[model samples]
Target: MNIIEDLRSRGLINQMTDDEGLEQHLNKEQVALYCGFDPTADSLHIGHLLPILMLKRFQEAGHRPIALVGGGTGLIGDPSGRSEERQLNEESVVQGWVSNIEDQLSKFIDFTDDDKGAKVVNNYDWLSQMSVIDLLRDVGKYFSVNYMLAKDSVESRIENGISYTEFTYMLLQSLDFLRLNQKENVTLQIGGSDQWGNITAGLELIRRTSQEGEDIKAYGLTVPLITKADGSKFGKTAGGAIWLDEKKTSPYEFYQFWVNADDRDVLKFLKSFTFLPLEEIEELKKEVEERPEQRTAQRRLAEEMTKMVHGEEALNQAKRITHALFKGDVKQLTKDEVEVGFKDVPTYKLEESEKGLVDLLVEASISSSKRQAREDIQNGAIYINDERQQDLKYVINADDQIDEAFTIIRRGKKKYFLIRHM
Candidate 1:
């Protein structure tokens, strides 16, 4: 199937400007399309994946994908989906985020110099050079105040008092499209549904500034804003946003996020996020219908996402941690895996080399008291490294530690505590 058809099948196409014409244009030649990512944070998160993957989809279809890091526009934050103005960051901070985001985007898009190889561009290069007078004379003149006000982005903010800096964000974005179209022969700009106004504004700028009968063919497309069936936000957990950077969110946690996808959302996530064949996904859909308790589809989704974002090694490590935890065989995990798997569990630092298992349980609050600890052990309710330790006098020695760093203590089936051997 063609790129547009594939995207539509995945429910990735939310809105397309002239869908018929854009499809024809894509089929005719190697169209260079771009999606701009504003460096609002030092790392891109799960929310940023759709647009980045959309670019990849086009590149796979023999088109050039441009990953535009909005070094210039990030400094002047886009107010497309906010209720209030965004706090502008220092130029140095934004530049650092720009570099970090570029590194993250590199993981997904192939930048090898070939016909369909992707290109990464920073708009700060040209936007920084243009003077205010030049912007007013060349780009601003083409946009009337009424025309700007009529846009959803501006209209929504009129009541909230948008700053002139933010109000003109559309114009700055428009300049990007026009500049790329002229210099790089870019014909399409893609973003999330929230960016529809800005994308179309850019298209308008390209048309207005073009020579009469120049055949300006710029178009815009947007992926839908992801929502959960439960009405909770996507890309969020109680901990916070699921970041792409492994340092921010470990591969284990990232894997868990997709692995725990809601029954209603897992199929949709599989379609949009993974490049798995549609036929394979259909089979998985049947698996979901026949036996969701197995969570086969969720596991596949997690494996695909974790492997794509983190390497195969990290994915293996995550799976090891997951399996070990589920099987209550955490002793099988390495020191690093232990740390990741039990990161949120209650923990106690053991300064002493060893201690009686009963006393350790009392000290770590795993049981209510010494009396309770002894009862739990005798009742076969207390476990050390998943091994039932009924001996009240049993000591938690170095052998109990996983890699001489941590000991997993379980009072029952699921409640776990971590003992750190200092």
Candidate 2:
């Protein structure tokens, strides 16, 4: 299938300007497209996945994808999805975040000089040198105040008060598109549905600012904003944002996030996120309908997505931890695996002064009181090193340690504790 058809089949195309004309243009030659990402945080979360995946599809379809780091725009937050004005970040903080985001994006695209290879651009280079007079006279005149105020982004914050800095955000963004179009010949801009207004503004600027009869053309496209079936925000868990960086989010947790996708959203997520062939996805859907208990579709989704973000070694480690945890076989896990897999579980150090199992359980917060601790041990509700410790008299000496330093403690099926020998 062609690029547009591929995007349509995968449900990635939510809104576009003149899809037929764009397809015809793509059929004649490779297109130059871009998507801008603001450096709002040091790491990108799962919410950034849709746009990045769309860029990947574009590259696969023999188009050049430019990943634009919003070093300039990030200083002035985009108010598209927010309910209120955002707290503006410091320039240094935003720059640091921009560096981090650029690094993360590099992993997802090819940056070689080959045709259709991805490229990275920073708007800060040009934006920082722009003077106020030039900006107001040259770019501001093209956008009217009435047109800017009518946008949902500006309209929603009317009562709460949108700052002048943010009010001028669209003009700056439009400048980026104009600059890119002039320099890189980038003809298409893509983003989440919320960016439709800004993207169209950029296209309008490109059209009006170019010399008369210059024949410069640009297009805008957007994908649906990802949301959970339950109406909660996507890319968040109890721990926090599911970061693309493995350090921020372990591979196992990242894999689990996709594996635990709601049944209603999995197919849609697969279409939007993965590059799996339509036929293969259709087969997986049938399998999901026939025997979802096996979770074959979920596993494949987890595997492909995990590998894409974390690489093969990390994916394997995640799978290993998943199997070990589910089978109650912690011994198979490596030292690093144990550290990462149980990082959030409470930990306590067992000093030589601690005399018995009761002291250990109480110290680890495994029980509320000494009496409860003793009762739990006697009732076979406590385990040390995955073995039942029914005897209240049992002492947790250094001899009962794993790796000569630690022991795994459990008060029940779910409550876990890690004890270190000091």
TM-score of each prediction: 0.97, 0.96
lDDT of each: 0.92, 0.87
**Candidate closest to the true structure, highest TM-score:** 1
**Model 2 Cα RMSD, Å?**
1.7
lDDT tens per residue, model 2, 1-422: 89888888887888999888788878879888999999988999889989988888888888899999999899888989788777889999999998899888888887777544679888988999989999999899999999999988889888889889888899999999999898888999999999988998999899898888787668999998877899877899898899998989999999999999877788888888888888999999998899988888889899999999999999999999889778777766766887777889998866683458887778778899999998999888997767788997888776676666667888889888887677
- Model 1 Cα lDDT, one tens digit per residue, 1-422: 89999999999999999989999999888899999999999999999999999988888888899999999999998989888999999999999999999999999998877544688999999999999999999999999999999888889999979999999999999999999898888999999999999999999999888899788799999999999999999999999999999999999999999999998999899999999998999999999999999999999999999999999999999999989988878878989889888889999999999899888888899998999988999999988899888898899898898988999998888899999999
Clashing pairs in 1: none
Task: Write down the worst ten-residue block by lDDT for model 1.
Answer: 110-119
TM-score of 2: 0.96
Give the runs in model 1 whose Cα sits over 4 Å from its true position: 113-116
